[model samples]
Target: MKEKKQNAVTALLEYAGNYKILTFAGLTLSAISMLCSIVPYVCIWLVARELISVLPDFYKVLNVETYGWIAFGFAVLGIIFYFAGLICTHLAAFRTAENIRKIGMAHIMKAPLGYFDNNASGLIRGRLDSAANDTETLLAHNLADIVGTIVLFAGMVILMFIFDWRMGIACLLSAVISIIAMFSMMGGKNAQLMADYQAAQDRMTKAGTEYVRGIPVVKIFQQTIDSFKTFKKAIEEYSDKAEYYQGKVCRIPQAVNLTFTEGAFIFLVPVVIILVPGALQSGDFIDLVTNFIFYAVFSAIISTALAKIMFASSGIMLASTALKRIDLVMKAPTLKNCHDPQIPKDNSVVFKNVSFTYDGSSLPALSHISFKAEAGQSIALVGPSGGGKTTLASLIPRFWDVDEGCVEVGKVNVKDIDQHVLMKQIAFVFQNTKLFKTSILENVRIANPDASYDDVMRALKAARCEDIIEKLPNGAETILGSEGTYLSGGEQQRIALARAILKDSPIIVLDEASAFADPENEVLIQKALSVLCKNRTVIMIAHRLSTIVNADKIIVLDEGHIVEEGTHQELLDKGGLYHKMWNDYNQAVKWKITSEKEAL
Candidate 1:
């Protein structure tokens, strides 16, 4: 058990990294300060001895002025040293926190898209930020408190023996009991409990975020907050767990610990009174009583010191949990790149009998999916939902490496190309457009930050977003989601298209760019898409069968396998899956409301 705790402490100190030197300096200074703090008590004992030597003639105490001056100086120096130590520790702590946050964000940026798919943005932000902040708190104040308390406790023990071992033992017994109470309360079971508590907190945060984002759907369905099962369940479970921990798990031990620590004097006075009479002569007994007073006064300091130690103990436990959470992201594998990278000579995309399974899943997302999209050709992947249309398109961008076979560009394996170079060669327009809370012009210019105002205007015009810019009060300078300057789904899509157009990459990947467009905006977005796709090699995943009728090639997939492949007319003649889907789509379009049919 002792070894386990030592290991945890070692891990935390190791994580301090470059700041360890500063931490060591702080600890050393804090120990010096603690020594100073205790020296004043020794001075007080000396003054007491001088007064005792004078006996009835109280005014004749020898060198009283010298003892008084020395004691005052020790007290003052303790405060100064404590302050200096804090300055060093806090500075080192801030630096450590900054580095951790930077390292965490860098890792997330390089992680695979599949990691994002399986985790919610809110969960990631909450867990990682909490972990970083917890570590910061530990380093900033908790660590100093911990080191100071240990030093103070050691000083008190040594002085106890020097003054009188019997009295020292009496004073030390009170501290031992307090320590026992603290440790017993947070026994072996607390580790698992702490883990459970953190998990519950994360679940509650995720559920709450999901509820807010889905509020529109909830209102449309006439749903009450209480009716949201996941959110409600999360709140209930978190509340229950917290209540159980506070009210039942550690409640008794905590109460006993606090009581014993705060009232240590109550346990001391009786023992002192009993010992004063029987141990020695009147003069010696007076000396023993004076030393007991030393123990009594220092007991208060001991209680305060141990309180700080207990807080540091809690910080250490919490930091252990935070580190485990951080390790999940830090240790996740990134896309591997070859030492010698090769450039693709052309924009042609090919899947050479590829297979892929999602992380933490047994079934393949795409299996044996072989196809070719030659340079300057528009290829559309159309299929039922969950049939791997989007998954196959994602592989081309190296979002996830294939489990079997390979995906290539210009006959070179995509894995062999540098990630930044691979990304520079392709542009994506997702169905759900994401815009930062920035000016319209800046959001559009994200594709090429170096592009000037005129260049951004050109791309916006090509994507048919001129009308959106004209309507905003600040024209293109207006901030998104501010001052009623928000755009509808269709407008956001066009702005996204403008971003893609600005990219001007050799390959364009569109995932139903017009999925949320109204009948009016659909035609405009389609027109913009035509402009974007004019000469680039395109791979599109569209739910709308009619829109991709003129695509250079259509691949129909089902359950991770390609079932059919052809153009509009050729597939219709073959009477295959695409032909059946086309006929079904036309029937749905022709269907109408009963009232419209009756009126007609």
Candidate 2:
């Protein structure tokens, strides 16, 4: 626990260190601003003291006019100081908040993908926003509070001592005692409250994202009430945490500190007034009273400042935790051994004794997998669910590196090539099509931004997307909803295929694009694939065996190992695992056709 706390503090310091100059400037401006706050109180004290003591002396010395001018000058100077501090304080606060936000966002962008996946976007947003709030509050309130309190208290103590040492000693002792009590009462409780609040916030954020993402599924199944139940529980837990912390941890301690500090001043003020007169002159007594008044005001303000600091510090702790989560993800070691992979000259990929296990998993997804596909040839991966077919395809893109062996393209280790360069040589269409909210043109353009309008049209035609395009209000200019919600599964798949076709890379990977297509859509996709596969190397994962029956080669996998490799006819002739899967698939297809005919 101690180590964690230290690490948290270190991370905060590191994050803040980037804005060292700005922080120092803020602190300096804050001190200057608070220093100005003392001007009014000091002037008030000086005026009261002189009125009680200086007027009579000045009249006796025959200098009434000069004394009047001197008092007027001091009053004007005091006002000037007060406004100067206010201006500086606000300027510092705004500047600091703006700078921190800009730097924090830049850091977030530099962070890795895993960081974003591991942490909730809301929590990250919360941290940046809260940090900005804290910075501004610290400057606008705590800065003035702390500096004003210190200057006022110090000035009061000095004046009191000049009047009488014994009274100064009493006031100093009381101030020290008050500070200790405040920290002891609230420090630990605030820390725990902040930690709990942050955890609750993250849970709520996660649940909200889940609810939004699953809303379509929930509504289709009439599961809205069940979803609400889960959401309600999350919200209730979050509220409970907030209420518990507010009552027990934050507000109570502040109330206690304020009551005790104010109450102490009441008792201390009278004691000083009663005891100081015996040891001082008339002017000295007035000075002592005025200083006591200053101390009382300073103490009240300081009490509030400390409470606020405690609260803000707790928020800072929560922010630090969020930042640490981001840091951990950004620091996760990417797969190494990549130095300079040779770009593919011909479209061929080879997996040599490849093995891989996902992070924190005990079993390998693919074990000792070896396969070869020549230039412009298609290799179909056929297997049961969880048979590592998708995993092996992912290796081609270096999504996750092979744990034990080499994955090569054109006789060069993929790890040695920069991902950017390697990606340019290949195009991938995943099982789940991902389309951003944008115009159809923009979505297809992502694969090759430099592709001309004619190129886009040709790719669209080849991918069998012209029919979907023609139905749209604006054709290629039509804006799609997020993840292409407006399009059917087959339509979206064809759009994705259009994108790959637009890319025109020599190597192409298709992960079950036909898995969800009906007979009509399937026929369209098959036609599109035939055109797209021309003069390109293709590796496809297929659940519908018929789609890949004519693939140049087919590899059958089960339990992380390839059980057989042969052409479709050759595999059937062997009468092994492939033969059985193919037979079952044929029977299912025939049964579906016969049932449809009978119904009609």
Candidate 3:
């Protein structure tokens, strides 16, 4: 059996959860309002009939005031019902949008951390938040208008034919043409054009976010907007799509639709003129004039109803595109949790013939890599750029899963361990550090929520942040990135080290932790590393080379493969890649020292 696919409105109702009844109630009320609104026009026809029956004697119309009051009552009733419908739909729309945002965020939260590398936070927020907002229009206004307009058209059809079938058909002809024009713009190949236009909009939004975040770099490079070619191209693409969709795809159809929709009486006028002669011969000229007046007044309602359909159809298309974007966020791959999780016996980390490749890449980042860091031992990964050092470190904490083979912790495969438990066993510090806009005390305590204020202070002290705290107005209580309380690159690194120290995990992974530190801060950060890595199974990626000279084991990697493995002195004795790298490091150091002396 084939399963049925849901349209955008149906899918949105599902998100409304318990509020689905409100949407139904709103639509019903909207339909009733449309029926009520038709009564006023019917009253007009009746009043006209009575007046024509007693021509030239206005005082003989006894029910004119009664019909006027009835019309006024139904008009007021229609407005009340419409407002009540709006209230119901507004509540449902709010709930649906809220649920969509929550569900989208919850789904993406479970995805692997590596997924964020390709998807930016701003882009994700735009997709979920902005797209959810777009759906509100369809739920609240467009849906009610659509239902009301449908009911209005049904009532109009019966009323039009009731007076005279010929006049009814003539009035309906313009509406038929208007509907055809509207569908021509909204359906078929133009529908695909709308989808493409929406896609171009999404690309533009993502590119704009990236451009804003890179403003600092752009200014530092002294570049103009043209320097960001991706952003410029995205803008141009969006503009082209907009112009093509409006000018080429929608222009003729839209013009035709409006022409017929606003001029619904065009066909009715000619039909009434032709019917006048036959009515005169049959002594029914007064009835013809009354019916003509009725149809002429009724034609206004046809224009209103068709306009609603046009706008509602446009809203439907926008909501469908928005739902597609929301689906993209919801469909991101999440890290699979084991049915029966295992606990590690110790902190030992191992990679057994691990081969991993990033998504959308033909080449593997790490291929057939094998190494182990025993409990309480420090293993260093030293390699040139693009040698998979960072990729190897990322695997230990399951930031990304291996494509083949396995990463094991304490002889248990990482995949078998519960995600929370696996995370508690390892603490990773990246080359770049991010600090929240909260107090330093809260930032450090985030690593261990149950940790006391005293515990956070102790961790900060161990990380040698006393110098940083002393200069702040509120010491450790000061908020970072607020009120002029910002830390330098090295200072932020120390704070990150403090977080890891507070976590007190059995395994620590450091990816070039001191890579960006100045000479003074580098010494402080190195001291902090000593305190954090004590008695832990440490996996370190280093580019400075000097930091890992005394490591328990050194693995030198090149081109995703291990080319040499030994202690620093043993590798130097072998006179291979490590030896040449060591010689180069020495020469660089000598050049730095000679240059400084010459400047002095």
Candidate 4:
């Protein structure tokens, strides 16, 4: 039951979809342009004929001016048709690119957050956006030219035979050889080579982006460009491979193709002379010479036409590779939505024997874990670094569906509930706070767009952001990430809390929400959390055990299993992982105090 693999051309056309009508129009116009393109050549032939008819008389041909005007008219028509074809093709190409990017973005939105964890953002952007751009160039610029050149090839063949079939064959000798050379050069092992090129480019792009984003750390560490292993290696590998590939594979064929095509007429002169006695000796002598003249004139143009084909073929290969990469993005699975979605009756959260494995991993991240946070209670998850605290909390919101067992909110399985409705019931505050590039007020208001300016202000105040806002020249109107109004980590963390407060969902999941807070902001953030978590079913993850000491329950986890669950003192009484972690935390706090006093 294997899926059939689509060729690159077919895949690209499928992506084009309904927009192909524009492509068809472009092709039709391009074909017309090709016919028109030969009109000037035809004019030359006609003028030659008239000139020969009045040989040495020089003034016998009347209305000779008419043919010149007609030739000019045909030339204008050819240019107009080609321009129109380009316009149509370009329109289709741009639209196709936009649609693919938009569609890819929409799929990424619906994909599991784990997808982001495994895939680099730069790699994804480079593959999708670069593919779209390559496709646009192929269809908008290359395809139109390809179609025009094909039509010209056909017209040239027909006209050559009409003039004289023997010399027609002679005229195409160089083109045929060039075509064979191109096929030999670009065909065998081409698929794998193109794929390798694309993969190398993607790796280089990912490394470049990572290096740029990490420049601050690099500068702080006083690292040289050569010390950035990934970036340096990627650049060198890409450069070396590209150089090797071009030098080894292309040099001979390209030189051969170019030389023979440009010199096709040289071969023709000897061939025509050899065939004249048999082919054109019985024909009128003047007619024979005239046809030879036409062939001589067309030989260079044939070379140009053949060259266009080679260029188009190269673009096709690149575009095909791009299309294949884009297809991979399109094929990524989205989270399934329930057809008959259930509604939750209350704000209680439950995980029952849930086992989950991350994509491309053999071991389960969470194994047969069970937990509950009853309505109007805050249950904090405490564990070592590799414990399943985040994974367990993530299950309730269906960030990933459990491979075994169910996660329920208010007695209904989370997967059975409508995704949007389920999201509406929960508010999330992550350790890494995310704020849009907008005003502080607008960022808070994103939680509830319908929330008024007054509502946002109240949330900001509750999250302890009043002092930060007051110092800004534009107050709430100042944009984030622009101008000179950048906030520290603690400040952004408060804004995140403000967003959660504004959301006011019945269920709140906080993953190390105050991890970024400075001492002064920590107290303010604690106050904000107390307000935001009031009467809500809260599932929180905190690295700082002191912050979660007053939770209704603390669940201690280790290596994908819950080791113990009870009140703070209750877990301390058990003398397990939690108890040891608590004892260590207290000793760390004492050491900090002792160190500070000694420094003073």
Candidate 5:
């Protein structure tokens, strides 16, 4: 079964939920207001009829003042209704936008953590926050205007033929031409161009965010804006899209639309001239003049109505594109939870014939791989870059689900375990640690929210962060990444270790945790690792071979396959891939030492 495609207005109304009633009420009121507005024009015709019937005997026009007051009253009533309609729409529009943002965020929160790696935070925020704002204009003002204009047009059609059909046809011709021109700008291939223009805008927003985030790198490299090629390209693409849509696509159609829309009375003058001889022959020149006055005044509203349609149509297209972008974020894959979740019996982790590939990729990141880290065992994964070390580590946490086979903890498949329970069993510390801009106490307490202040203090002490805390003014209460209280990369790494220590999970997955630390910090990080790894089933990935030489088991991976697995000394004796990598690492370390001494 295929799903029914909803129009933009209908899709947006879904987000309104209970507020949809307000939107309907607003449209109804707007239509009634438009009908009321037409009464004044009818009154003008009646006033003209009375005055012309008495021809130069102006005082004989007894109903002229009555008609004037009626026109004034209807005009005032129209304004009040219009304003009241706007109030209803504005309230609904605000709630609709709020719901869009709230629903988008809630959906995104359920998405897998790995999704953020491919989708930039800026792009997601722009889609949810800014795109929702775009829809507000459509719902608040454009929708009401559209409804009012439609009602006005329907009433105009009936009134047009009532006086003189010929004059009515002439007045309607301009509106017909204007409608055609407006649709030409929005319909067919041009609709696709508008969508492309919006896509380019999204790309520019994403690129701008990436450029801003990389500004520090740019400054460090002494580079200019031109050096940020992606941002520059995105800007150029957006400009080109805007230029092409406005200059090439919309230029002629827009001109035609505006010319016909504003000049709706253009055809009325010639039609009245043609009808003059017949009126004179029928001795009804007074009627002709009166009907001409009515049509002429009515033509003015043709311009207002057509202009509303043009802008309203534009709003519809913009909102439709915005909803599509929101859909992209909402469609992100989320980790599926088992209905009957099972708890793991033990801390032992095992992989059985596991093979996984990233989305949109042909080759597997890990192929037919099997390994185990028994409770309290330390297993180190070491290999060249892109050897599936990080990918394998990520699988244990179900960052990306496996394409084949299963990962088990305590003999229970990870997919069968409750996501929250699974997360509680393992703690991960990556090379690039992220700390929120909050107090140090809060940052560490995130790992174990129920843990007491004393427990956090003990974890920090165990992670060898005493020196870091002592140097700060407020100790654990000091805010990080603000007020000049920023920690060095190594210091941040130690703090991350403290977080993991506070978590106190039986399984710890460390991915190049000390890769960015300076030599002094490296020593401190190693000491912290010792405390963290104690009595835990540790799965460590490291480029620094020295750190993992003493592991109970070392696994060497290459091109998604495990090439060798054994104790470090046993692998060294075997002279396999691990042995060769160890030799290369030793040569690099010796070269670094000699280079430093020579430089001194």
Candidate 6:
């Protein structure tokens, strides 16, 4: 908990560094506000003492014009300070939040790509929300309370000492004891409650995100409201835990303050009357009453400060946890490249004993895998699901670094080439076609945002999306539904193809680009594929073997091992895993066709 507190403080300072001016202003405003807060307390004393001094008989309440005027003047001063502090506090608090958000976003974006993969998107979102909450807590409670409490505590102590040393000593000791008790009790039950609440909130966030993203799948499977039970359970646990801990920590502080306040009054009154009566005179008695009032107000402020710290301690811990999580990602060492490595002179990829493993996994995804693809030459990766084919394809673009050997582009180590230069040479079309929720033209333009209308049209025609576009009233301007739900699977793939064409990169990675197409759509897609693959270094992962039959090489993977490597004709002649799998797949397709014809 101590370490977490330190880390949270560090993170806050680091984030706040960007808006140092704002932070300074906030501190100044808070101090000014605290200074103003003292006015009302002092005014009350002045009014009370003056009323006593002016009254002929203390019991008789008589008109006190000077007292009234003095009180009004003090009240105006108090109001001015109150509002000034409010405005400044808010300004500082909001600016701190804004700075944190900016830095947090930059940190996440600049982090390694693998960071995004290992952690859930929902979890990242949760931390962002947590950071904002933490900042608010720090500004609203920690910042304001600390400033106000110090001023109030100090002022009251001085006033008490001036009035009577005995009362002053008692009050000071009680304040110290209260603060010590608060710190001691705050860690155990208070921290536990906070941890429970944070855990519950994280679970709910994850569940909510899943519910939204998988709503369609859930409805299709007739599992509506699947998250309702979990949500209710989380809320219940959070509420129960909060109430339990709230009673545990807060009640103790309340008891401590009550005991000390009552004890001071009971023990000190008789002592003061005996020891300080001659010194008290009439003025001293008034001082005693006013000093007690000051002590009362000051004690409230001190108790409030302790309470703020107790609650904010949990926030600080959570924020620390979030910052550490974020830092782990942000500080991850991304694969860096040279200043200006030559763009692929030709789209030839060579892997020399390359290997890779996802973090925390014992086994490598691609083990000692080696292969080569020359410019304009096609290579097909064939394997059952989970056979490293996708992993191997990801390496060409340097998504994950090889643990053992190197991957080269145009005979140069990829690590030595600039990332932009390398990415410019490669275009990837994944099995799952992802279309943004925007106009089809804008979606395609993501590949090359500066491409002209003619360029868009040419690419669309090549991908056979022109016909589809012409059918729509808005043509390419038509907005896609969520993840292009408005379009069919085949149409989405065509749009994806159009994006790849717009990229016009020298090397292309096609992972099941046409896997979802119907036969008629597949025929058109195959034509588009031919156009896309023309004069490009292409590595295609084909589920349907027919797509890669004419490729220069077909490499088969079993588990993490490369079981076979050959051309389509050569692999068939060898009659190994590739041949048997190819034969089985062909038979299945034929059987499906026969069954469909029969149904027709």
TM-score of each: 0.94, 0.80, 0.95, 0.94, 0.93, 0.84
Model 5 scores a C-alpha lDDT of 0.90
- Residues 1-600, candidate 3: write the lDDT tens digits: 001113888889989999999999999999999999999988998999999999889889999999999999999999999999999999999999999999998999899887887887777887789889999999999999988998988988898888799999998998988878876776766767777887898789879978998999999999999999999999999999999889988899889888887887788778877888888899999889888889888888787888888778778877888888799899998889999999999999989999999988999999999888889999999989999998898888788999999999999999999999999999989998989999999989999999999999999999999999999999999988788889999999999999999999999999999999999999999999999999999999998999999899999999899999999999999999999999999888888444766898
Q: lDDT score, residue 187, model 1? A: 60
Model 1: lDDT equals 0.84
lDDT of 1 by residue, 277-321 (tens): 775755477777677677777778867887898888777777677
Better of 5 and 6 by lDDT: 5
- Higher-scoring candidate on lDDT, 3 or 4: 3
Please count the clashing residue pairs in each candidate, in the order shown.
0, 5, 0, 0, 0, 0
The residue pairs found clashing in candidate 2 are 338-415, 339-416, 340-416, 341-416, 341-417
lDDT of every predicted structure (CA atoms): 0.84, 0.71, 0.90, 0.85, 0.90, 0.73
Per-residue lDDT of 166-189 in model 2, one digit per residue for the tens?
A: 545655555555565555543554
Tens-digit lDDT track of model 6 for 176-257: 6666666555555465656666666666666666667777877787885744566556657766766666676667865885
lDDT over C-alpha atoms for residue 227 of model 4: 75
The TM-score obtained by model 6 is 0.84
* TM-score of model number 2: 0.80
Candidate 5: deviation at residue 517, Å?
1.5
How would the candidate models be sorted by lDDT, starting from the highest?
5, 3, 4, 1, 6, 2
Candidate 1: minimum summed lDDT over ten consecutive residues — where? 1-10
How do the residues 1-600 of candidate 4 rate in per-residue lDDT, one tens digit apiece? 001112655566666778888888998998899899897887777778778878898799765678788888988999999899989999989888888899899988897666765676766887799889988878887777788898899999999899888788988888888987786666666545645665787689878988999999999999988879999999988887677667777778879898999888887788767867865557676777777778888887877888777777767767777877787788776889999999999999988999998877888889999888889999999999989899888888888889999999988999899888998999999998878899999999999999999999999999889998999989988999887679988899999999999998999999998897889988888899989999999999988999998999999889899889999999999899999999999988787444766898
